[model samples]
Target: MDWEPHARRLADTVLRRRESRWWNVLASTPRHVFVPAWWEHGTSGPVARNGPDDPAAWLKTAYQDTTLITRMGTRHADHTTPGTLLPSGPWPTSSSTLPTLLVTMYRHAMLGPDSHTLVTTGTGYGTALACRRLRDPSLVTSIDIDPYLVTAATERLDAIGLHPRTAACDITTNLPGEFDRIVSTVSVRPLPASWLHGLRPGGRLVTTIAGTGLLLVADKADDGTANGYITADQASFMRTRHGDDYDTASPPPSVWDAADGDGDTVTTSRYPLLDVQNTWDIRSMLELQAPGIEHRFHRSTDGPRTAWMAHPDGSWARAAAPDRRTSPLVHQGGPRRLWDTLETIRDRLNRTGQLPVHGAQATITPDGQTTLRRGRWSATL
Candidate 1:
């Protein structure tokens, strides 16, 4: 089947809002080659689709401006049989990031004709775009913690006649070489020290903060520290992983059950129930204020809705309301008041109309300590 037209159409869609030099790169690259098969999460479970078996659907879906999940819980779609449906509960482990987001990240890097770039090899599509943008495969190096991903991405890139250095290493611990630009598709907490060490002086690193939607663009300084501001554009990526799968650090069932039950202190909330997961800014601010809080929201067919927040520190909050417009009855337990913190943030937002996380000034020390400051508000991670 002819896939060029689909790819060109995709490029047009992705670059329609703005003019970019990546237009030709996106138009010419065959995204279907990089994503031959993928998993789609549905109401039932994750269903696998094999590209070769359905060429038309493959071309259509592959060219769309959407992320295609390639790996979930170590089960790569490439290795899974077509029409296979897996039981729910395993989250996506790897994917070909949406084209527009990829362009946004690459544009932030400000890659030049000869810039040495280091990129995460998720499906090799982003690395392919970088190679095409640089016009020299040797100037691009791709790495992944999953050895199978590294090997498969390397072979796929080679099949497309683009060869760049590929390695399997935990990016949190070490980097293979120094480069002018480091663009990661995965989020990291407290910026990794090895990234700082691997970055050449004056080099730029573009990545997102884990557990938040803050896109960080920092340039290395002579003193080994990096200073930059969080971009107004928000993005979220899978956190960096050292092993085959991400660590299961979610709050236990008992903790969630406790959050659902009556709280140590129950009171009526000042505002209506808001699902933190739906709003990026509010969720990002709450994560900054109360780090490691797992949020869950449930809405029944009727008008009632409930939101739950649980932290690893034995703190949990539950808020339930009769409808969207009504105030919620909040229950708080343990040491900290998670819902109160969220309400305080919401209150600030309602009063000031903004949160400090966006465009916040960020400074990362040589040891990977990140400090975000905006006016009088400051936070460290």
Candidate 2:
């Protein structure tokens, strides 16, 4: 079947939302080509899907403006290519971040026709959007830590009749050159000093600051410091992958045995354990501040629901309810109280009418450590 109509429909969704002038990039960019083989999690290894073979399903998902994790567990989908189902571990390696989120990021970067840009490439989706917006292959440089992803994105962009300089390099260690703007699709722990140094004076950089609840949109100062505001928005892309994604596992027996079952009281939650992927506010905030925390919610046939949030940092929370409309009795334990953090932020939002993000001051150290200070509360990640 022809795919253009489906692409148009997806573009229509984006346009209706007034998200991006570059929405056609989503329609024109052949997502399936870049993501021919991808992994999805199940009980065992990730289930693999073939774009050419599963054209209908592929077209449908590709057009929906949703993020698709193209790699999972330990496997890099680009390297493994199309074959059969691959083993999935416990972490996502790469993804096509949802179209709207991609648009928001680019829009936030404030790229203009004169801008020289550097972007991180995972699935090449965001790079495609950048090329579409700037329309100058020479102005955009896309880099990836994984040589395999860089290679694949290079070929796919070529196939689509778009070309930007693509490189296999570590962005955290060194940026290829000074840029008028830098936008990263990956979550990073801080605004790399290299990025600040590599930015032309007065150039702006937009990226999700890793391991925290923040996004930084900053301009380089004369002294090489980039200062900007923390956006009220939150986003979390997979952290730039290294050789592998998953870390050594903690003993499951100890995890369960140590789980607090005491005042970890069980009660009803005011909201359903939100499938954050479907919720805009919380998901964006979570992405900006605390990406990679996984959520598990159990709902019974009788409407009883229990939700658990777990993070790699040894944090976990259990919140449950007998029905859909009550506040949950929450139980939390770990090095840090994960739920407490969430609730604390939520409370700040409730009382102050907003969380401290927009207009928050961002100071990027030469070492790449970023500290976002909002009034009396300051956070670093």
Candidate 3:
């Protein structure tokens, strides 16, 4: 069976809704060469998919707009057994990001003919795409913190006769090279100062903020600062890992279990229960008001809906109702009223008829301080 025609069809279908700026690269690149095995989040946890064991399935999944989890926690799919157990949830340490999101970041970066690019390499499929577009391994530098990942990606890129500058290093620390465009598939909290220092004047950077699905786009100015606006479209990726696992964002057992318990201030919710993460504006605003808050949602077969929102700052809120159309009974506890803050932000958005976060401006100072401002609200992350 010829896979090239299938790859071309996949690219045509996936790029139908977006600009066809990268159809050629996706159509020609062989995804299975980069991602041989991956995992899927199951009801209990993640289950591994051995690509070589099923070539047809691998070809189909590789071209879809889905994230292939190449590494779970510390266990790479290449090294995992059928009974290997991870300590926690199927947290993806590294993977090939969704193709749509990858293209979105690249589109936002707006690379030019003379632009030198810096990108993060996970499975290296993205680096392959970049090399295809930029047409030079010399103009692209891709890095990952895990030496194993870097080595594997280097080997895979070479297998396809495409070689870019691949390195193992912490992206937040000293970068590998100067770049006209810095695009990261992994998320970071505050914009890294090193990125600003490494970006040539008038260069652009596109990346997602950790803990929220906010895409940050900025351009370096002559004053040694980078400033840009948030895009309305949302995209998120795994947070940059240092050693192996990500820092736990799960709330304490007490706070998580008693999320619906009484609080310092309790009242009816201004709006119905919502999956904040699904909304770019609401999630971004809540993340700003209460940093590092964990959110969850559940519903019975034919009963009420429950939304649990918790923060590491000892705050949690539960909104419950028989139907989502009706207002939810809310319970909150902590020094800070997280639900109230979310409601306030939502109310402000309702009044203003738009989210400030949608087009909020971001500024990164020379020393690495990052700030987001819209109207009178400004937050330094």
| Candidate whose lDDT is highest | 1
Question: Which prediction has the highest TM-score against the true structure?
Answer: 1
* lDDT for model 1: 0.92
Q: Which of the predicted structures, 1 or 3, would earn the higher lDDT when compared with the native?
A: 1
- How well does candidate 3 score on lDDT at residue 52? 77
lDDT of 2: 0.72
Error of 3 at 198 (Å): 0.9
lDDT of 1 by residue, 1-381 (tens): 799999889989999842668889998899999999999876789999999999999999999999999999889999999888987777789999999999999999999898999999999999999999999999999999999889999999999899999999988987998989999999999799999999999999999999999999999999999999899888999988879998978777778888878899999998878889989989998888788899889998669999999987789999999888889999999889998899899899999999899989999999999999999999998
As a whole number from 0 to 100, the lDDT of residue 104 in candidate 3 is: 83
In angstroms, give how far residue 96 of model 1 lies from its true place. 0.5
Which consecutive 10 residues in model 1 have the weakest lDDT in total? 16-25
Candidate 2, residues 282-329: lDDT per residue as tens digits?
Answer: 544564566566666667776877766776666677777776665677
Model 1 misplacement above 4 A: 17-19
For candidate 2, the TM-score is 0.81
- Model 1 error, position 324 (Å): 1.0
lDDT, residue 169, candidate 3: 95
Query: What's the alpha carbon RMSD for model 1?
Result: 1.3
